[model samples]
Target chain A: MDDETRALIDALVADARESPADLARQTGLSAEEVEARLADLEESGVLRGYSAVVDWDRTDETGVEAVLEVNVELDRETAYDDVARRIAESPLVDTMRLVSGDYDFEVYVRAGSMGAVSRFVSEEVAPLPAVTSTVTHFAMETYKERGVLFDDGDDDDRLSVTP
Target chain B: MSDETGSEAADRSDGTAPPDPADSVEGSDQSDPAEASDPTGEGETTAGDRFTAADRVARVPPSGIRAFFEVAEAHDDVVSLGVGEPDFSAPWPARSAAVASLERGRTSYTANRGTAELRRAIAGRVERYGHAYDPDEEVLVTTGASEAVDLAFRAFVDPGDTVALPTPTYVSYEPGVTFAGGDPLAVPTYHEDDWALTPEALAEAGADEAEMLVLCYPNNPTGATMSADELDAVAAFCVDNDLLVVSDEIYAALTYDGDHESVATRPGMRERTVVINGFSKAYAMTGLRLGYALAPPGAIEAMTTVHQYGMLSAPTTAQHAAVAAIERCDDEVARMRREYDRRRRYLTARLRELGLAVAEPSGAFYAFPRVTDVAPDGDDEAFATDLLDEVGVAAVPGSAFGSGGAGHLRLSYATGMGELKEATRRLERYLDGR
Candidate 1:
């Protein structure tokens, strides 16, 4: 049962929208097995969620994306989790991680504009009680997002036919 | 694809690096054998000319894949299941290491046997396959697995010695043997046996006369894989006959069901086997052209002798990248293998539903479907040509891979599942119209 669950998760990791039939074939489990296993995963929250990988720049509304490194001076009660929870309340935070080395937390900020991003960092984030120092490294380009290359440089370079 | 045949890169695709006559792809009907057999009209010779291709060079026939390439080249929207390489890119670390090698100015030639690090890596990689080779003496890295095959036959086989090649395998093996001055004895391995060479079949094919046996499995064109028990039988036969074995395990890591057993691991087989493997199929580094030969010291020395005098060494950047591939990219290899396995299952099931007899492929990316149901009288070539013209989908005729492969179409599952689904739809439509 756990084997099927792992296979399902692996297949889902490759293509979130993969049909149950393809998932079944890929994982070597029956369609019913896939359905049951997926339901189990969702029920247990082992499968977190499925979402689309979007490049906001390509869409109508352009956004500035940046990595905000927050080094917080935490008290005995204000743990890393508390800091993450407070910072994550802002909608600008796309992803938050309590990363080690050089920073206490790494927050990915994606906003409609550079001014919005700066405003969110200054007004909402920097003023936090535990926040000691913060560094903003704005991304000029998003070359890859969620493992998908933004460009077609990985085109097939092989000859039309080879043995 | 048809537009740029003059480049040096295109020539490397050919087994012997023959000049591509694909510029004629504009008008010539490649379906005609007479025209295709002499693609460049180089067969027309003049007595006064100073340069004539030697009998060894002229004797090797044009690969059956050439016509299919030309047919595919003529079309714009071809969803080809005819490719033999992996669709995945090289693992990120390997790609980055290649870039780093250039950035670090390691652009000069490597050792004739390859760099110490890469040779050690090759030794370690082959060690996982259950054979231990001395990195300094037993591993000889070549331009690609294709080159290692040529060097193996050339190093061991004499002018008239025969090399037994199983039918319906990689197209390069036969020509490669011939080019090395060895007569290739075609031992037909039937689809009934999953395209594997059995002891009885070997004896019937008079393999006892051959000095060496050539193998590729999980195979190309057929995707047949043999169990360790089956390999033990063949390995015993090789021992009894005292024949050398050149086993190409390029598709070894891509085996879908069960483990891929190397013939070298069999008793009495290690000393006689020259193990050829590469990053092309498994690591998706075909463009890098990195492969290695693991053999006994004597065989490696001979192959290196031929390699140094002719090809010298493999690309330095490629060697460094290969080390990184061996050390850091196993997860990437597994991911690619899983993807191919998924596509393989999808293609095989869909083709079977379409009323074609598909031997469930247990290895490699190909699904060899017998086309006698649609292609009456087993004329796969004509059937394939019609399939291309009737629909825009392209596939290689099984006859292209040699005997025991006739009456079938070798459809590759190397592309994306979406593309396979679309190709299968077109195939279903073609079948329905039939």
Candidate 2:
């Protein structure tokens, strides 16, 4: 991407709620220019979509989160894709990606409770024909997520000056 | 030869041998020139009394902007909007290049005109404005745009010549001209007209008699800029009056809303213009002390001669850093400019919301807001002092700039957003309590 486009993307990444006018003012581009460039970015898949960075812990419907390492017996033709797709289709799965090292896939699963997560892993995930083994690690506390730091109190970014 | 002999006779009459030019020249190679010129204690004089400053130097007042910084520094908890400097550090590539240069022991001075690579880079950059300066003949690297201003004034302005300058400026041009033995004729630009310099104002300031006209776009203190058509009119006036133009585009890269149009790019202006720009404001490279002047060959030669005698050259390592900045830091500069723009809009909007009459600055990182509503006697200095004393939010009085700036305040938004917001809050509370 061109520098201007890259800057535009950076601005959006920093604050997705910035209006076209705000983006234009910030990027030194006209509103129309920002709009056109944004559309181009969307078309090129450089900008997928914008979503809220929710503090799930603050909400009443907070879910139990765990990281699952799945070692799969790859079907030589389809590789790990077939087993990975099966695991991704589950509702409890928040994120899934093929990983290197001993694990074939690293998956993030979230459920209403710890029991639900455990039940899903044991009953659903372990039953997958290609899934050879699975290891689950539950999250204790999230200190930071998606660049937002929780419980960061009294952090003053101002420089110390006498005046 | 007669004048030299006459002066020598006068010196001998005073019981001090006349300084033999040859001995003094050779003595300079072995010892201090001042000491060599007067080796005996008979001519012993206090350092301060030995050399008197020129009348023009005495005529110029101490910088009001610097005084404000001192005041700000003296007070604790002062949230200063007084400084014009950017809070951001210099971009990494520029800093890294300087570090690399130092590691490689590249500590000696470069060409007095600056490194060829930097000059060429500058030429490439300014080409966007449609002025293709021959880097070899037309560019001179300077300590900063400040030095460039001093050099341009000294180069073009003869003693007692007048240099027309717009008021509510960067606070250096007037003194720079005065120090160079020129009179600075203040051309008043009012907030009523958004502070843009008009041709009428130029004529009213007596441009006909003025040898030069100083222009600063994305102007400091006022944060005002002229449109291309507005600049065209000013150019026409300069052409009509046969005035050399010293255009300080130091803040050119920080211009918002539209592209900055250099006065030199206008018709009939190239031959008579000196464009001064620097890395400080644009790339956050203030401490690097690097800047340049783009002028015609004759003007460049004149400035270069002054530069050679005065500074020799800009810092060697900084020049290398500037090359990196010019080549690889456009994206970083653009990023910083965007941040400044965001702050500008926020501060302008917030200041207006607090009932201050602020001309939303179209360029630079300052908001020139009228604080007459808050000042008991409509005094900007009093208002600024009171603001600092009461709320600890520091801002520069408009009067510090010039008479035309008497009722306003130059609030720099170069600080972070959090500080700006807090400063605004303090200002609001201070105003409300008053």
DockQ of each: 0.37, 0.08
lDDT assessment of candidate 1: 0.79
| Residue-by-residue lDDT tens digits, candidate 2, B40-93 | 223344465464334554355544543454456668877777656677778999
Query: Candidate 2, residue B228: CA error in Å?
Result: 1.0
User: Best by DockQ, which number?
Assistant: 1
In every candidate, how many clashes are there?
0, 1
Cα deviation of B264 in candidate 2 (Å)? 0.6
Model 1 residue A34 CA deviation in Å: 1.0
Expressed as tens digits, the lDDT of each residue in A18-51 for candidate 1 is 9998788777778898898889889998888998
lDDT of 1 at A154: 39
- In TM-score terms, candidate 1 sits at 0.89
Poorest stretch of ten by lDDT in candidate 2 chain B: B1-10
Error of 2 at B114 (Å): 1.2
Query: What's the interface RMS deviation of candidate 2?
Result: 16.4
